[model samples]
Target: MLPRLIDEHWRRIGFTQRPKLAAIKHLCREVDLLHPQVDDNGRRPDNVEYPWTGASGSAEVPAHWKFPLMSRLHDPSGKLLLKAAVGLTRNPAMFIR
Candidate 1:
């Protein structure tokens, strides 16, 4: 799953820059082993499902679509280093200590 996603990312961006690849690799490892499995059918009653606003309505909407990938991964505890590497936050120091 991770490899395929990374490959798709590389193809999308036209290059696999070292830092980006490294971050992707790290995230692949850091993500809980069951995280990908949850994509199958983990929708909760409390979970909100916003309408997919793509230009083409024919595009397949994922069953578990909620937030963008980056936003879903954003947290002080789970993948702060990856967030820092991606410049999602300017100050990781607060999360670190």
Candidate 2:
């Protein structure tokens, strides 16, 4: 959802070009990882909204654990995402087509 919104914003602003900021790109990838899509085999187990069986044979709820993507919330990419989100919220018209 966030990546879609951000991509739309970039497109609207005519900013869809190569060499996107490394931090923002990393942040987008991390966000994407949070919402894994099940493949044909239905084997994608990592998700942020449900419980799944861990390798140790224990039920693991995402909310009860700090996933790697969650930990990136304190990193540079996360900070960039937060800043961009706040800017969008504060002045949405700037990105509106």
Candidate 3:
């Protein structure tokens, strides 16, 4: 269910594209945007054990389950992104249909 949510919202707005993805990546590096990413301890909502000790970890997350949600300058959940996408290109006449 949640996986579909990301596709519908984020990717739908062109986040999956090379340009947008690169732009977001660059924006994050240029700014000091640090979002919550499941502290190094890998604390899960269910209190599960973290699998990594940061020995040979790559820059990007291994997987979604390995990371936590956070709000950074490059956060894909900014208010502007939500509002702009909301009701975008809606047909007013459809309300009557």
What is candidate 2's lDDT per residue for 4-97, written digit by digit as tens?
Answer: 5566676776765722356567666666666756422455476787788887989989878676666776776576577667877898765466
66 Cα displacement, candidate 3 (Å): 6.7
Q: What's the lDDT for candidate 1?
A: 0.42
Instruction: Locate the minimum summed-lDDT window of 10 residues in model 1.
Output: 43-52
Q: What is the TM-score of each candidate against the true structure?
A: 0.24, 0.60, 0.21
lDDT of 3 by residue, 10-31 (tens): 5545664422444343433322
lDDT of 3 at 72: 38
- Superposition TM-score, candidate 3 onto the true structure: 0.21
lDDT of each: 0.42, 0.66, 0.36
Worst 10 residues of 2 by lDDT: 36-45
Tell me each candidate's RMSD, in Å, in order. 14.0, 4.7, 11.9
Query: What residue runs in model 2 are displaced by over 4 Å at the alpha carbon?
Result: 1-20, 36-44
lDDT score of residue 75 within candidate 3: 58
Query: What ranges in model 1 sit over 4 Å off?
Result: 12-19, 33-72, 75-97
Clash pairs for candidate 1: none
